[model samples]
Target chain A: MKPAQFDYADPRSVEDAVALLQQHGADAKILAGGQSLVPLLNMRLARPAVIIDVGKLRDLDYIRDDGDALVIGALTTQRSVERSELVAREHPLLAATTRYIAHPQIRNRGTFGGSIAHADPAAECPALAVALDMQITVVGPGGARVIAAADFFVTYLTTSLEQDEILTDVRVPKLTPGTGWSIQEVARRHGDFAMAGAICTLTLERGRCAAARIALFGVGAVPVRAPEAEQTIIGQEPNAALFEEAGARASAEISEPLADIHGSSEFRRHLAGVMTQRALTEAFSRAEAR
Target chain B: MTAKRDVSLTVNGVAYSASVEPRMTLVDLLRGELGLTGTHVGCEHGVCGACTILLNGQAVRSCIMLAVQADGAELMTVEGLSEDGQLHPIQQAFVGQRGLQCGFCTPGFLMSVYELLQHNPAPGDDEIKEALGGELCRCTGYQSILRSVRDAAARLRGEVPAAATEGEA
Candidate 1:
């Protein structure tokens, strides 16, 4: 069960890492935390001719507060972000969602940008990013460019990043005042991938929903934003009926959800509505408290 | 295929250098090259925690991490838990609490609890369960493991007599 033979290089700088990726193109794999990629390598699911080890790229591992968003370096471990007081205070939804990732050991070695870049449809971060309208930063041979979360995920286990690109960071905008957020998922076990999950965030102005964002995962090829669901509840008084209607709309919007041994498409579709309803109710309650 | 790379790492506070293949996992390095076979390899993927070890003081799956990745790094396998033949409090607590049955997964559980007690010496039942959830154990039904962690925490905090952990009684 050893990984396939491959050349390994620990790039000292981000630019050097990007340069290596450009040179190797499709033959090189970038190593961040190696929580996801190493497993793939062992399984021969991925057999890159070369591996660019970014583990020692200390510059890429950080969490900083920008004026408008929390800029997280790509190498930041999930456990560090989960235990970060700043993330907890400013982005409680992210902090909470991070705890559900895998387990303490996995999180200690899993990186934020790696998860986002992996773009697992059942993963929590992608769905949360879509709901929060986060930006994914990628550096390539051409230059640095920003890709919106919506555009970054192209399909299941595939992303919009070119073969020569490396996802460097993510920009999670700070929630505006009086905004509440929640991510709800129904995984069989505590740390398992959710069968159905929803991320809901809403800003309330004087007891009415001023803005809302709804996104669902584990129900489609890619994490989906429920525009109709968001439209149904925006600018309306938050209530059980409104939440239920929004959830129903989300369930209706997504088409042909994945079916596997985990759960049936019908079950996931049903759980989507249920999870969306619970997420909205919790998010509204939090907003009310704010 | 890439040539073997020379890697020097500190394992259990002892510095050792070896030339390892790039594909050799850290667990294989510990078991095959250095002969520290206490760290078990279960699942060979990241899912099973049998290969868990302290990489820079954080629990990580050694099976999935490359040996070359640990170059110039510090690692602690389950063998490093005790000092001078004395069982570490966690290991002693495992024996005292009957935390092992088949004993295959004990090393992983020990390292995990070692980390938990290092960070939070007074973890509640829920916290203990959450931390232990990372590894799988088919034996002991976990209640004994929970008790073992609590005992380990108490021993570390000086709440229990040191002689009690020495298996004297």
Candidate 2:
């Protein structure tokens, strides 16, 4: 399963990497951690004319605490995020979600920005990005621009990023005070892609839900935000019954759920509901504890 | 055909330089060119951890990483585990614990365990399982492998004598 022959370029800087992208357009693929892309290359599913290796862009490998937000470089490995004490203290949901990724071996090399840019429907990074409303920054010939996480992912393996743009960094806002979050997924194996998953955040004001965010993955073309389900939880006091209704709404909201050997469309739809219910239940308890 | 690129890296404590195709994976370079065949190849994709190795002290799937990408990096393969023709404590623990049947997945497991024990000398069972979650073993049902890791951790932590775990291999 060797990769097909392809020219390679090691770009030292972000501008140089963007220039190469501009030169090759879509014919070239950016090689960040190469956790996902390299496998596709090995199987010849992805035969890029050129591979622009951005591994040497050391500047884009960092985790910075920027007051209200955590600015993570696109090249920051998932393992780094998993081990970051700042993330553990400030954004526990992010820290916990990072562990739900493949495994330590893959996480050691998989870049944060690469996962978000790859936009795998079953991946936790994109769903977490959407659930937290993270901001993604991409650099191109026209300089850098930021895209809301909601607008970042367009479809399966596709993002709003232009052909010549390289995702530079992601800005994850710290969890609001009294906000509690949970991520839950069911995979065939511990490290396999989830069959279906849910990520939710709850903020309780007084005795009612003041803010609620819910996102589902592995059941659609992209990680989807369940606004209808979220609306069900926002104004109501969260209980097991309320969570069940919201889960049903979230499941119903999915117009098309992906089906494969792993699970049927109906099974995934059912799992989406179950996962949403479980995540909401856990989040509610955590919010109450806070 | 793509033009070959020059790559220089240190593997198993020795420096090596080679010219390889850009599409060549690090595992291929290690096994085919460098002759470190201890790092077996079960799946060329990243799913199987047969080609796992240490790159700059981090366990990674070498099959999914390009050889050129490993340029100027320090690496450790399964072949590097033993010292002075002596089996490493982890390998001894595997031998003692019967952690293998076919032995094809052992090398990847050993490298992964090496990294794990290096980071956490006293990892609990859950920690060991999480660290080894990527590796796939068809034989032994992973129970023996888990025992081997626990034994290896004790051996490394100086709680158990390495000689006491020596088995007839």
Fnat (0 to 1) per candidate: 0.78, 0.95
- Pairs clashing within candidate 2: none
C-alpha DockQ for predicted model 1: 0.74
Query: Across residues B1-169, which tens digit of lDDT does each residue of candidate 2 receive?
Result: 7899999999999999999999999999999999989998988888889899999999999999999999999999988889999999999999888888799999999999999999899999899999999999987678878888998988888776444333532
* Residue range with the least summed lDDT across 10 consecutive positions in model 2 chain A: A173-182
Candidate 1: segments with Cα more than 4 A from true spot = B161-169
> RMSD, each candidate, Å?
2.4, 1.7
In candidate 2, chain A reaches a TM of: 0.99
Q: Tens digit of lDDT per residue, candidate 1, span B1-169?
A: 5887999999999999999888888999999999999999999888768999999998888998888888998999898989899999888888887788788888889988988888998999998988888788986778778878888898899886333333322
Expressed as tens digits, the lDDT of each residue in A146-264 for candidate 2 is: 99999999988999999999999999988787788899999998889999999999999997999999999999999999999999999798899999999999999998899999999
Q: Residue A4 of model 2: what lDDT?
A: 84
